[model samples]
Structures are given as C-alpha cells and as structure tokens.
Target chain A: MGEFEIFGMPVSLGTMIFQAVIFTALIWILKQKFLSKLVGAMESRRESIDNQLNLAETYKHEAEEELLKQREMTEKATQEAKQIIAKAREEANIIVKAARKEAFTIRTEAYENERRALKGRGAS
Target chain B: MHATRPLVQIFGLTFDLSIIITSTIAALVVLVFAYACTRHITAKKPGKMQNLLEWVIEFVQNIMVNSMGRKDNLFILAGGVGLILYLFIANIMGVPFSFIAGADHATWWKSPTADAHVTMTLAIMMIVYTHFIHIRLHGLKNYFLSFFKPFKALFAINILEQFCTTLTLGLRLFGNIYAGEVMLGILAAAAMKGFQSGIFIGIGSSMLAAIPMMIWQVFCLFIGAIQAYIFVTLFMVYIGQRVNEATT
Candidate 1:
C-alpha cells in the first residue's frame, strides 16, 4: 500500500475503486429490476383509481338528470289527467239536463190530448 | 490489532482482500434481501416482503419529495433506495459476529462501512454524482457560477465546504460503525478473559459482559438505520439544492 495512511487507518485505492464499482452495480441492478417495477405498478394503480372516480362522477350526474326528467314527465301526466276528468264531468251534466226537459214535454202533450177527447164525447 | 489488511497485489495496485470479501458478502446479502422482498410484488394483494419493500420505496419517495418539492426524479429515487438498503445492511453486518484469522489476527469479517475507504468512496461517489446532476440540470456555466453565489468573496469557503461535506458524510458513518465494533471487540475480549480465568468467574463476568454486548448490538442496529436515513436524506438535500436553486 506504499505507507498511505489517513487518521491511522491504511488507505487503499483498490478497495475504494472496488467498492465504488459495487455500489454503482447495486444502483443499476436495483433501478432496472425492482424500483422500476414497483413505480410502474403504483402509477398504473393510481391511473385506474382516477379513471374509476371519474366514471362514478359521470354516472352520478347522469342518474340525477334522468331522475329529473322522470319527475317532470310524471307531473305533466297528472295535470293532463285532471283536465280530462273536469271535461267529462261538464259533458255529463249537460246531457242529463237535456234529457229531463224532453221527458217533461212529452208527458204534458199526452195529458192535453186525453182531456180533449172526453169533452167531444159528452157533447155528442 | 493487525497493522495492515491482507493485501493482494493486482496490476500494481494493492487491494485489501478482507474488505473485498466482507463487502462482497454485504452486497450479496443486500441483493438476496432485495430479491426476497420484491419477488412476488403485487399491485393489489402485496405479500409481507412486498409490503416492506413498498414501504421502503415510499419512504425514500417521501424523502425526495420533501427535499426536492415533488420533482419527478426516478433515477435519484432508485439510487436513494439502493443507498439506504445497502448502507443499513452493511452497517449492521458486523453486529452479529466478527471473524479474525491467522497468526496476525487479520480481520476476515466485519462491516464494510466500518472502514474509512469504503465510506469515503461512497461519499465521493455521491458527491461526484451530485455535481454531475448539478451540471446536467443547470449547465456547466451555471454550476460554476454557483460557487460564487450572492458574492465573489465566498468562493473559497464554498470550495472548502464541499470537502467538508465529503469528509463528514464519510467519516460520520465510519466513526459510528467503527466505534461500535471496537466496543464490541472489547466486550468480547473481556468475556473471553473471563472464561480463561476460571469457570465460576467466567460464567459471572461473561454474563455481565453479555448484557452490555446485547445492548450495544441493539443500539448498533438503531445507529445503522439512523445513519442510513441521514446519509440518504443529506444526499437528497444536496440534490435538492442543485435542482431547486434556479426556482428559489
């Protein structure tokens, strides 16, 4: 080692170089094999989570819109049903009034004709 | 203690074989651990190892984001994970057992991080990489101008600070791990001395030393993890300084 010493410890260039190489190799191998895989997995998982969240948000919005449309349709149908019932009641009242007037007229005419016939027989 | 490590001359450079071996062992252990923790990684249903690995990655991500403000730097994130894993594993490698062999009692096994060479090399590598990143991010001219930032009078201080950063970053880890191992060695020697003196005294003193040793080992584990976190965090902070300097 040619008497190289630092702080009472022998310093060797070979050992330093060897260790540096080992450390570099360690970093390269780990980066290539393990860290990349883990990071990739994490990234994909995050992307999927984001995608699912976005999908849920859109679905919720669509469901709300559909519920609103169904409510409006039900309201319109109820209003139309009320209008039809009111028109049917008005038509039934008019028909019953006309029928009662016609029956009263017919009874009056029959009574008058019978009285006139009795008077003629007495005169004869 | 041996004055020199077992040296193997190769191509005019003297290599410390023990550091090489222990470091290789530490590196292999890290590799195996990484594989074990990541073998069955599932995005949906993660296993225990997967969960731990994910947690570590997330932790590193949080550190980077905290420092750099959500900048997308995958390379740095990967390096951060590698750094923390390797450092934590290497720092604790000497806690369980140490191996010394031959007549000179050459150390065959220990934490590679306990040695100044490995730690300094790591520190240098990180600093150099940081500079490279700085240059790549802000151009060479900007990086050069950064040394004189806010005024021209502080250039020397800025230059000195870089050296200080490297030294402190390396030596802090070395100092902690080395102290830990030195104390462990002392305790082990005391225990051995107890066993050598007599059976009853050996049992008593050995038991006495065992408590401290166990406690030190646990403390070393905590130190290892903390040091790893600090090292990686500081490295990120340095990178963050470079990356966010333009914006700030």
Candidate 2:
C-alpha cells in the first residue's frame, strides 16, 4: 500500500485500493460479457470471408480443369475420326486400283481375242 | 473545502456515499453503451449498434496492433474497449454529477475522478498490470534481469520509471479532473449571488456565470474523451515498449 501511494493525495491508500479492486472486478465482468463476444464475432467474420475466397478459388480451378478435360476429349475424338477416315480412304484407293487393273487386263485380253479372231477370219 | 459524509456503513470503513452514487451512474451509462448497444452482435449482418461496436473495437484494435503485433491477441482483447469506456465515463463524470444535494458544498456528487483516491488506485493498478504484462510477455527471470539492460547503471532508473509512470499517470488525470471540477464549483459559487437578486446587476452577473459554465461543459466533453484515450493509449504504449524487442 505504501508503494502504491505515489505523490500522495488527500485520500487514504486503502480507499484507492478498494476502488481499484472494484474496477478490476468490473473489468473481468465486462471481459466475459462484452469484449470476448465482439472479438469472437470479428474472428468469425474474418474466417467466413477467407472460406468464401478459398471456395471461389477452388471453383475457378475446378472449372478450368473441366474445360481442359472436355477439350482433350474432343481433340482425341477428332484425331481418332481423322485416322479412321484416312485409313478408309487408303483402303478404298487400294480396292479401286485393283479393280481398275483387273478391268484393264480383261479388256486387253478380250480386245486381243477379238483382233485375233478378226485376223483369223480375214486370213481364212 | 473537501469533505464526504458517509452514506452507508460498509464493514468498518466510512464510505463516501456520493462517490459511490455518482460512480454507479457513470458505470451504468458505460454499461448501456457497452452491452446494451452491442447486444445480439453479428458477424455478417451488422445493425447500427453492431456498427458502433465494430468501430470502437477496430479503433482500439488498431492502437493495440500498432503497438504489439496481432500475435498478442489475448492482451489486445483484455485491454480492449472496456477500459476506454470506463475511463471516458470516469473522466466526464464531473459534468453529469455536478449538483450538490446537501446544504454544505463539502458533500457533492461530482465525479469519482475528482477524488484522488480513485485515480491513484487506477494508477497503482496500471503499474501492477504493466509489470504483469512484462513478465507475461518475457518470462520472470528475463524480465527482472532486463532491468539492468546494456549496463547496471540503468537498474535504479528502470525501477524508478515504473513508480514515476504510476504517479504521473494517476496525478495527471486526477489533476485535470480535480482542477476542472474545482473551477466549476467556483463558477457555481459565483453564480449563487446572481440568481438571488432580481436587479440588473444580478442579471449581468448571472450572464457572466452562464457563459463560462456552458463553454467549460462543452470543453469538458473534449477533455474527457482525450484524457481517456491518452490514459489507455499510454498504458498500451508502456506495455508495448516493455514487450518490444527494440525498447528492451
């Protein structure tokens, strides 16, 4: 109490201590009811804001991933279709070439036969 | 002429009932501002009360964070808006409770802050709490040893600074409030003779009394708020200096 009294006042140290003790009690009570609640609300608000931001970021990334996947699938399907079409075109070319060759040979042979028959008839 | 009559007998000590009564009123005013306004506070949708509460919290939080970083959340919360409200109410108590109910001027219901005991108590508490915070931030051994600092010569000065802080903080507030209230009392005393008569001289004296009292009351508002801010900010700053690595 002596240490607490500094520059000395009209009132007793006991009275000052009593007042301070009352004030401390009030501080504790106010802490429980007021300060803690407001701080909690602020903290909760900050956390919710962070959560919303993170959620938005995740949604954006997920959307980009979905877009990339769709593009890859479409690209793969286009390449497969092109490969099939090219293979079918090559097969058609081979078949058409063989058919043309066979027709030409048959025509040539018939022409030759017809010429030979004409020659025979003329010779006869 | 300073005197207080006992309003009630509490234990063996004679209590100054006016201080209790006036202080109770001030405390209630603060309580309403603190709790009633902030009741049903929300994180998302804030009402006007919440807005005010948030503003005050942000203001105090900014001061605390500027001193010590955000890591000291416990300290911040503990030294938050409550102290400001209490001290502001305490400081301005002279305005609301200036009326003397009794025959004698000795027994008036002015602010408890006008009383040195109350202010000194708060100062002593500040001293105790400042040391407590220093120890809490830096352990006991380190806090005690740090008083020696770069050299042993500063040891006495460091110890004396704590006492000086308590005295200065307490007396500064007490002096301001006590002096202000005393001046108001003088004004009131001067005006008593004016209203007693119906003459032109009385009217002139009454006008003289009216101007200073009104002006001082308005000024009282500013002084009260500024003193409260200074007191709380100084406490935080002192603690900050103690806990700060640079100051140590």
- How much DockQ does model 2 earn? 0.21
- Model 1 residue pairs with clashes: none
| CA lDDT of every candidate | 0.88, 0.75
Using Cα atoms, each model's DockQ against the true complex is 0.44, 0.21
Docking class of 2: incorrect
Off by over 4 Å in 2: A1-9, A53-124, B1-14, B197-200, B245-247
Q: What share of the true interface contacts does each candidate keep?
A: 0.74, 0.44
Span of 10 residues, lowest total lDDT, candidate 2 chain B = B1-10
- Candidate 2 has an lDDT of 0.75
Candidate 1 lDDT over B41-74, as tens digits, reads 7667678887888889899999998998873678
lDDT of 2 by residue, B1-248 (tens): 44444444455554566667666666667777877756888889778888887787788887787776653465445555767887788888777446655555456567787776677777787778877877887789878888888689999998888889998998888888888888777787677666677577677887898899888887877888887888878877877777784453
Show the lowest summed lDDT stretch of 10 residues, model 1 chain B.
B1-10
Model 2 Cα lDDT, one tens digit per residue, A1-124: 1223335623444455457666776777667777778778888999999999999999999999999999999999999999999999999999999999999999999999999999999998
